[model samples]
Each structure stands twice: as structure tokens, then as C-alpha cells.
Target: MPVTSIVKDPEALSLTVHAEFPVKVARLWDAYLDARQLEKFWGPAEYPATFTRHDAAAGGRSNYHMTSPEGEEFHGYWEWNEVVEHKFFEVTDGFAHPDGTPNTDLPVNRMVFSFDPTPEGTKLTITAAFDSAEDMEQVVAMGMIDGTRSAMSQIEQVLIDLRNYSQTFATEAELVSDTQVRVVRLVRGTRQQVWDAHHDAALVKRWQYGPDGWSMTKCDLASGIGESYLLWWAPEDGGQGFGFSGKILERVEGHYESSTEQLEGGEEILGSGVPGSVNQQTFTGTTGGTLVTTLITYRDKAARDAMLATGMADGMEASYARLESIL
Candidate 1:
């Protein structure tokens, strides 16, 4: 578990809580914006919190309540003051009534959440300022520190759940025929962005490798019909290298692209005379993002089964996971 530190500054009438997560900054930062994700770790272990309203933008307001073991409810609300994407945000937080009204008698604290990218991952620092030292001391004495620590302890698991959910969300592969396989995923970008990521050599090099300890050594992409392209990958340990080269068969700018991809120099691994596949990639705009569908047509059933045996679906999933980071 990552260490979570809580510090109090009486002179400044502030309390700061710090925690580090072994996840990308964007993922960690997104947790706050997502209402469902926030409910997973917004309170202590025993007292689960529920969000009634979550609007994550500057001037937005959020209302939530935590239920105690005895079924008592503690409501809270946040008035967002500033929001900077993937970096930090400021909000005024305080106790509220069950009907989403603030409790004027309770202490209102200003909280600033700072997300810093570290070598290991992301470090999140939460600085909360009260109107006076007495107010800060009053909250601290009410087990605020312990409650925060307990809540922060759940973040690691939340991140894991988010990752697992992301890897499986809207991702599927099915064999449509003996000679064809369709793979689909909801990519987090527009059609043009997804198209550029696939066609641009620089972006392709960042996510072409499907697994760890392998890197794309060379990638040459020509974006027109009848153009030629080559992509090569080498193991980090300088092991055997493999690649694919082919000519584009069809292209529709940001909508679709098709090419005949032939594996090069993998006879030992894939067996002799393994035929190539016609790979077609299609991108469509969706309400949430872009829907990317890949169709691979093999020469015959033998070629399709051979490709499946290579765990091609798993490789595609892994590669898409990498692509999600860049997008």
C-alpha cells in the first residue's frame, strides 16, 4: 500500500493530506470527476458515501452523503471554484442538509487538490484551509484525519477496478466466418484523432507493440491508397525481430483504411507459408467517443485458426490498452 501522510499547520489554519498512486495521472485525476468512481473511496471503509449530484467543472456543485453503521446520514456539498484539467482543482466543501442545503453553522473549508506526476506515478496533495485555527482544530478533533486516511486507503483498489473496467469496456472480438474475424473497441477520441493515431508513424510507434518488453523499431506509413508501409518490432533483450510489410488496398481518409498485411521472417514461430490477412480498420463517431472496428480476412480457415492460436485477440486488446494512454 502507498503511504498517505496527513499534516496540520495551526498557524496557517490548514491541513494537508498526501497520497501516491501507481497509476497514470490522467486516470487518477479522472476519479474525482466521475461520480461513481468517487463514491467508491469518498468516505471511510465502513461508512460508504453516495453522490446525488456530481458536476465536475468550475462553478459546478456536487452533493453527497455518507451513511453510518447506525443508518445516520451525513450530507456534504462542494462548490467548485477552479478546475484545471489533469492538474488541480479548488472547491469549497462543508456539511450540508439532507435536501442539498448547506449547514451554515458548520465549518466551510476551501480545498485545493494538486496532482503531480512523479517518476513512479502520480502524487496527489490535498490542502484544506479553514477560516480559523479553531475551526481546523475542531474538524481534526472530530476524526477528520483518520477518516481521510481510511478513505485514501481505498483509492488503490479503486484504480485497479477502473483499469480492469477500462480494459474490458466495449472491447470484443468475434469470428464472423471461417475466414474473417472482427474486433471492436470504443476508443476515447474523435474519428479523426483515432485515424491519425493509426496512420501517423510517430503515434503508431508509441502504441504498435502489443506487449511489454517489445518496442517498434521502425515504422513507415504512407497514407494513400496503393501506398506501402512497414512496421518492425524487436524485443528489449535483442531477441528475434519480426515485422509486417504490405501495400494499402483502400483508404477513406478519417473513415476507413485497408491493407494486405504479410508477416515477414516469422516462419519458425508461425510455421511455414503462413498466408497474410487483409486488415481493414473503420472508425465511426459515437456519442461517447469513436468506435473502431477491425476486420481481418484470412486466406482460409487454416490461416484464421493459426492466427487465433497466436492469441491475436489478446495482443489486440493489449495494444489498444497502450493506445488508450496516448489518446
Candidate 2:
């Protein structure tokens, strides 16, 4: 592949690599655009990598975060210099704190990626130039090239697998049984704003789901121990269809939990039914700011089985991902 055929510049401090995969440009382009798809493949050479605030558009910005050997997180952002759809794109990259504060000491890089279509497949050429030889040496020693190669290879594989999966499952909706769906991710801009997003019926509908014909008929949010909110879903088929109903049974100043069994119907009878779950949301003061934890418990057995089947511990980890965006 192109990554294996890389050669450093003899006169200048630079490296150029070409990777040729037996995949079409269109397939690779889709993988690059979908944030979810990118999440599956994008990362550095050795350790796992993550991206945030990713807007792959002109004049947009994003941050890449990766963990070190000691579990220290290092992150950087790239403000797009240029974006040319599936053809090529350029960006100016630099180190930064998770909160977008730039670090001045780390060297900045301008990288250009060109995607060219070939008869055999797609050819991707990457050119990243550093300000000095030391900069190049430092990054190479850090194994940046290996990380990039692995990420690109992963992108190609995702495309190939997606095509195969689509063909294999054509008749029905993809069954993500025992999956975690996003409930709400709140980043507190203010105490009142946080409360409104979670408690206000009108505002909740804007960000949360609104099913067909179902609407919030009544909601009450009080401040003391009895403070609570309830949403009554009115099914389109006039109560004969599927609907959802939930209430805040208990509310602490900074947290609340939703009871699953009460909403789904009395506790499940053995294998016949499972109790509704509970969602407990807590807000704590942190050095960075307020950190919120929305812990959801779906009875021990149900939660454990779901985790074991899907390689996920609980919905908390997945919820945290959606929370990162809301915050």
C-alpha cells in the first residue's frame, strides 16, 4: 500500500506516503464524512483515539484526543484550511486542551490529503510538512505515521464491511436489540437553563424525541421533595398504539432517577416481563466545571446480558458520548 512506500525528503524535513486500497473513492469518502463511521476507524497508531466537535466543512474545527501510556490524555485541534469534498482537504493542526485552549509550545502542522480515483481502486496521498527537522523527527519517533496508516486502513475496511452487511440484511430494520438509545445530554449553561431543558415540557420536545401524534399532555416541576415532571404520550392510534409514559419519582437538588418498572407495567413475571429501569442523573462541581453523571440501571440481569451481548458495559458509556456534544 501507499503507506508502506513512504520516503522522507532528502533535502527538506518532510514525509510523503501513498496508500492504494482496492476500494472506490466514493466508499472511502462516505466513511470520511460520517462522524460515526470516522469514530470507528480514526485514531493514532497505537492507542485509541477520539474526535470531538468535528465539523468537516470549510472554516470548521475539531479536536483529536488520545491517551498516553500513563493514561494522560493529549488532544489537538485542526481548523480546516480547505475542504474539497471527496477530492482533497487541508487543515492547520495544533495541540490544545479539551476545552479548546491552545498550547503554544507544540509544533503546528499543515496537512493535505488528496483522494484520487484509479482503475484498480482509490489512491490516497498524504503530505504533512513540519516547520523543522526536529519537529519531523519528534513526530516520527512518536509513531504518528503508524497511527495514520492504521486509521486509514480501518476506514477502508469499514466501507467493505458496510457493503457486505447491507446485502446480508435487506428485508428488515437493523435489529440493535438491547441497545442504548440517547435519552438526554445536558451541559449546564446555568441552573435555570439546566432545569428547563430537563423539566420544561415544551423545551424537552425540541431536543428530545417527539413521536407521531404523541404529545406532553401534562407536566409539573416543583422545587421541594415532591418536585417532579411527567410526560404522557398520546399514540396516534388513539391509545391503542404504542406509547411511553414516565415520571420523576424522586428528585434530589442535583439529580433524579426514572423508574422503569412503574412505567413499563408492573415488574416482569419471570421471563415474561422485566421491570422498567431507573435513570439517576447527578451533577457535581469540578475544577473544570460541573460534571454530570446520568446513571441508568435496568435491573442487574437485563443490563448484564445486554452488555455481554454487545461488547458494552452499560448505557452510561454510550450516553457519555452523546453528553460530550451537549456539554
- Which numbered prediction scores highest in lDDT against the true structure? 1
lDDT (10s digit) by residue, model 2, range 12-129: 6777878887777766665554334555776754455555445455565665677667777788887777877579888887889766677877778788878899998888887888
Best by TM-score: 1
Per-residue lDDT tens digits of candidate 1, residues 181-221? 77778788876788888988889988887468888998988
Error of 2 at 61 (Å): 0.8
Q: Which ten residues in a row have the lowest lDDT in candidate 1?
A: 162-171
Q: List the residue pairs that clash in candidate 2.
A: 2-18, 2-19, 44-147, 45-147, 260-276, 260-277, 261-276, 268-273
Residue 152 displacement in candidate 1 (angstroms)? 0.6
User: All candidates' TM-scores?
Assistant: 0.53, 0.52
Where does candidate 1 clash, by residue pair? none
